[model samples]
Target: MAYKFALCLTLPHNTTKMKKKTIILLILAAIVGLAQFIRPDNIKKYENGVKTEDLAGVPKEVNEILRNSCFNCHSSSSELAWYDKITPVSFLVASHIQEGTEVLNFKDWMSMSIAKQKAVLYYSINKIRSGEMPLSSYILAHPAAKINKNQMQVLEAYLLSISARGKTDSVKLKALERDHKWVKPALNGIAYMPDYRNWKAISTTDRFDNGTMRIIFANEVAVAAIKAKNINPWPDGSVLAKAAWTQEIALDGSVSTGQFVQVEYMIKDSKKYAKTEGWGWARWKGDDLRPYGKTINFTTECISCHRPVRENDNVFTIPLNLK
Candidate 1:
């Protein structure tokens, strides 16, 4: 009986230790819960910066380099990876993206003044050349974002080439901006005319890292063709608009889009647009509805991009998952 009583006395010491462990566990659980509740409100302010696939005027070879190394924070196409979903990590990502866009968002290339664009390009070249970009911390997490020597050369060359062209024709490009063709009212034509947001979302795509997200919306006629699975020549009168946004990151580690970036329209007219392969191409940029292809040279430039898909009715909406 005495020995049993002695053993019972030791039980209190174990219970005390158990109580401490339980308290520590409860504190940890509480801390985690509190962390979750204190998350950011995460308002989706506007279309994201601009997506990789949406970068206009960037050549394919250099585009690949940009997509591979610079797109994440620099472009609106930043989609966080699996590791970025953690709470504090996601917070850091969101903060970097917000700051990155403010510094210089490549997605705003077409929207910014040509002079400003040239200046930004030079700044970017300096940063990349000095190993200052793709942030060291960012590179630690995403080694792929590390710009290589060859890619650096290609990017700098492309930027210099564009800068030279801009310097030579800065006046012309600016003047052309006022002379938009396929004339519309002095209002935001493509954005407001039909209100693309109300249209059916035909498909969305990843642009690697040129820094944009592209979501295609189909007008009623085009939606019908998509639903019927009858987009052979994509009957005349069908309209499809692709909206580009700067891809941002939310506190939840999901893609949070920012303000309006760009939108492109493809109107089917087998007869009228036959020369361009049966599609009328037009692009409206920023909130002002700045026309992209203001001149014949620019208009034909659109053809080269779509020329590859000529067999697909001069449309890039083929692989889109329609709903």
Candidate 2:
């Protein structure tokens, strides 16, 4: 009689547990079902067409690789899978597409200038090489988007083939020696900072697209921020200067900095330049130190190009740790 009573007590507890689980499962099912009815507002049915012709001069193989891997997210002619249409997941896919297109859209390939196209291609390759492109989450869902070593080599080779290679012109080298004591300010009101040459070198980069090499320098305030590892917001008064020069390739494939091409600066002052994302943007192109842009609105181009790295405080260079 005692054993029977114990079994009866346990039965009710088990039954109650099962009932709670069933209720929870039902609630989840209802939520999922309701989500299906609500689609993302930005999600649109992408046209199932491949516009390979838009990339006219791109090699056939490269075009195929881009179509298979990048076009879906980077172009207007995206081809979506059945699973990508599911709610919540579809919303994420739409966001990725929106962000990807904003950074680099192949649909506008023909519209870009030759130099701009090369720069875009170079930037795209860099992203791919860094394992940042075809985002890990994206590759998990779309296995075909994963680029292999061979595909990467093909892209690199194509870029190198198009890159300008040769000796630098002596005339341009001589032109860089001119005095810059009275350089004019950019149309946006940021004056030329000649003393940036004395700043500490923070990082260096090679621009394969434009066939130039660049050195990034940080002013005293910027350097202090780097040392403290407090560069995300990069405290007010921080200044960074990037000086670019033509790349001179020797017969043995060694590359050296040649004639000075340009120097760009980013000054930080959150309240002072609140309208321009808390940074003063200015660029002086060529040895003559002529300010870039015809009007004050030139900052639009700077903001657009740096938009992809907005998370990095709109700065691209990752400063090396200082002692």
Candidate 3:
């Protein structure tokens, strides 16, 4: 009788524990089911269709590779997988597509100048070679988007074939030497600072599209801000200079600087430059140092190109850390 009583009491306690577990599982299931109804706004509805005519000059093979690897996020014709439509995952997918298009939109391809198109291709090639594109998270779900080595070689060859080599102009060179001391100010009133050549080089870049190499130099104010890790706004009076030169390729495949191309400057003064994103933008092209714009509105192009990096104060170069 005593053993029977103890057994009966334990059965009720075990039943209560099982009932609590069942209730907890049902609540979790309900939460997951309800979450499925909370979907993000479809980003595709607002996008324009990408037509073949928009990519008129692109070779078919190159276009195929770009469409397969890049268009899903960079263009309007994004192909979302079934799993990508899930609530949380769909939100992430939409965010990625939005950011990608903001950085480089294929829909704007035909609208860009031929020179700008080439520059975009060069920049894209660099990102692909570095494996910084197609995003690892994205590639995980869509393996077909990963660019293969053969595709990479094809893109590289096309870029090289289109790049024009710099030609020598002795008369122009002589004139440039003679007029070295009389460079003019930009249309927006930013003066040419020839002494930027003496500033410390903070970074270097190559423009394969134009067959040019560039060196970025920072003024003392910029350098100090960089060292102090306070360069987001780049303190007032900070100046940066980017000088470019044509690249001369030797028979042995060696490359060296050839002719001067242009030099651009960015001077930070938040209050003074409030209308131009807190920086005075200027560019002087060629060895003769001719100002690059007919009107002050030319700064509009610079502002647009740097808009994607607004979080970084519209600055692109990340300065090297000082020892």
Model 2 C-alpha lDDT per residue in residues 1-323, reported as the tens digit of each score = 99999999999999999999999999998998899898876666453445435486689888888888999889886788889988888889888988888888898876554555678889999999999998999999999999999999999999887774644533432333334443678999998898888899999999999999999999999999999999999999999999999999999999999999999999999999999989999999875578999999999999999999999999999998876
Q: What lDDT tens digits, residue by residue, belong to model 1 across residues 45-138?
A: 2123334564555588876766676667777667667666455666787777778878877776666555555577678878888888879999
Q: Please state every model's RMSD to the true fold in angstroms.
A: 20.4, 19.2, 18.5
Q: Model 1 RMSD to the real structure?
A: 20.4
* Model 2 poorest ten-residue lDDT run: 169-178
Candidate 2: lDDT of 212? Answer: 97
The Cα error of candidate 2 at residue 197, in Å, is 43
Model 3, position 143: C-alpha lDDT score: 93
Q: How many backbone clashes can be found in candidate 3?
A: 0
Q: Rate the local accuracy (lDDT) of all candidates.
A: 0.70, 0.86, 0.83
Better of 2 and 3 by lDDT: 2
Looking at candidate 1, what is the lDDT of residue 315?
Answer: 82
Off by over 4 Å in 1: 1-30, 43-53, 163-323
